[model samples]
Target: MSSAEKGLRATGLCREFAGRDGSVRKAVDGVDLVVRPGELVSVLGPNGAGKTTTVRMLTGLLLPTSGSITVGGYDMVRQRRRAALACGFSLGGDTGLYPRLTAQQNLSFFGMMYGLRGDRLERRAARLLEEVDLADRAKDAVGSFSRGMKQRLHLARALLHDPAVLILDEPSAGLDPQSAASMRALVARLTGEGRSILLTTHDMREAEELSDRIVLMMGGRIRTESTAADLRLAAADRLGHVVNVAFADGRVPAELEHCPGILGEERDGGTVTLRVTDGAASVEWILKTFPGRTTSVSVTPPTLEEVFLDLVAAS
Candidate 1:
């Protein structure tokens, strides 16, 4: 099948759990998500927003209460094995790796379960270790590896079968800054290779940097789904654009004190920030009005975190 045909799709997915007093708790409500080939979509949500539940259902670990999920065009419930073969998943944490086993050994075991063996398995394991920058530590026990190293090994394990789609759950969670940057670089490479990727992350900056589209979930439902630019644009309608101007003497120009489009303004040490209706016009006006007095000026749309906060607070 073509790569596009192998993209991930979930329609009206839902999962319910039995709670105390025979109450029914819907962990995942009617959620629909799609990740096309050569694209990356990030799912962002606070704790208990059903991201994990939805991911489990999509990956065939948990069957949906009522919905359909397809990976590489294979049904997740009916043709699970086939779907699994077409999908590679890396779930964060320290659960999958065997502490005493070497990295190479770990890959070999998983490969065998995937029906790989002999020279093919060995070569695949070696290549993956190299790809994840763990080739030199191939024979070292997994327990000896760092958290970031183990996380990369998890990614290597997921790619053993060369699946067409990838699902990553907080791939960089708990990673140090340098390690997280490395992991993000690796994920970016995967996206460049034209595989469909669905990433669930709490890092708004990471999502903003990596995703082609972002889906924000709240209370087991999607609050919004769109490109990062579009999300910011949508927020601008409600909160307006944010502009920060740095002045040499920390003074607010009298010209801008009563500017028509300036809805709000605040002052800090050598800096003045404003909330204006039109970003471009406000920026242009600021530059023209301040001239030499303004040292630096920047106009930006609302950040992902700001948008997320607004959604949560409004709800």
Candidate 2:
């Protein structure tokens, strides 16, 4: 499929709400985004930075004040019904399952909404329950399931129609390690089947692990969007290529912020913790400057957390 047909596209997206003070609050501001089929893109931002608002607009829950959105080749606004059927979104709280209904019944109910019935609905529900590791509990009421179990059920519900695009908001929230891992695996599996996924998460690790591209947002606008490797390379350029340090005798170097390529340095006892720009070449210079005083040295990979924080800080 072509780029526009593969997934979702939003251009010049903006939303404004009348504030309590009778002023306008720009919840989303001129954001542009694209997600391709079989790709998992993570949208991230600080609180009130328009992440949820953006999702709401993309999923057709709210209309954008300006700009256009398309999902699975359908215009989100002008072709609302087609767009709604093309995407599945779970906003992460309750599973929206009927608590009194058995797991099988709940799945069947949602399946029927998607026009699956009889043997097809039963087969699909059974397969989905197994996919979510809830086959054993299919006959039990959803209320009897754990929080994690409910979350998985929600995933199954979202997948009932086999939407071409999936938007998951904080899918791993409140899940235990095993449950969260399962959810991530499921997301990966769906994307492998050529389904596009737009996921939002406060969990940095989840974003780093699952997203093909990460979009960092702050103050209701995107600060940057790139792959994990691209973000690290960009941050390295700003931070520095190398760092050299000298320590005073008897006392380790105190916290010092020096050098064009160095971000910051902290001292503990006789050790200096340096946050350097680049790893390979910077270590060579550090060894020459400190010599024996350096004691020990470690080179670290750039983490998404670091890049994300730096982007937000710059914004």
Candidate 3:
């Protein structure tokens, strides 16, 4: 199948649960998600946003109350075996690992479940350990490994089947800065190899850095879906523009604090960031009003986290 036809897709996906009082609550309400081949889409949301429920449905773990899911052209609900075979998942945190087993042993076991056997399973297990930088620790029991090491093993297990689509739920969570960076690099490499990836993460930087598209989901529905740049721009339009200014004497002047066209201002060390209705006017006002206090000024889009909070709060 062509790349366009070989990816993960969900249409009108919804999952509802009955509360103790018989009140039905929708955990996921008509969420439509897609990750094209060679692309990575990140889903971001606050707590109880139905992200977990949606992912479970997509992975065939939990059945959707309504809607359809297709992974690599196979119906997830009807052709479950084929859909499962077509997609792999790395669900981070404490899940699906034999703490007493060695890394190689763990991979080998999961590989067999994927129908791999004999020398093929052994070879794939070895290669994957090396790929995740865990070859040296392959013989070590998983229980002894660090959180980051366990995360890498989860990734290796997910890839053992060599599926066409991958789903990662906070693959970098609990890892140190260096380990997180390494995990992100591996995720990026997987997309370049033409595998579609659907990632759900709370880390704003991770979503912004690795995702081709960022999906903002809240109240069990997708509020916005766009590229990082476009999302930032859209958020700016919905709210206001960001103007970062560094003072000339490395000090913010009190006189320029409540200037025109400036919606709000925040001081960060030597730089003063202003949220303005007009980007050009804000910069001009700062320069013309107090040219001596301004050393450098640039209009830039709000950060991804900023965009996320602004949109979520507004919604």
lDDT for model 2 comes to: 0.83
Of the pair 2 and 3, which is ahead by lDDT?
3
Query: Candidate 2: minimum summed lDDT over ten consecutive residues — where?
Result: 252-261
- Residue-level lDDT of model 1, residues 187-253, one tens digit each, is 9999999899999999999999999999999989998999999999899878789999899877776
lDDT of 2 by residue, 186-207 (tens): 8888889988899999899889
Which pairs clash inside model 3? Answer: none
lDDT per residue as tens, model 3, 21-73: 99999999999988889999999999898899988999999999999999999
Model 1, residue 77: what's the lDDT? 96
2 or 3, greater by TM-score = 3
The TM-score of candidate 1 is 0.94
lDDT by candidate, in order shown: 0.90, 0.83, 0.90
Q: Candidate 3 — which residues are off by over 4 angstroms? A: 251-255, 267-270, 290-293
Output the lDDT of residue 142, model 3: 96
The true-versus-predicted C-alpha distance at residue 287 of model 3, in Å, is: 3.4
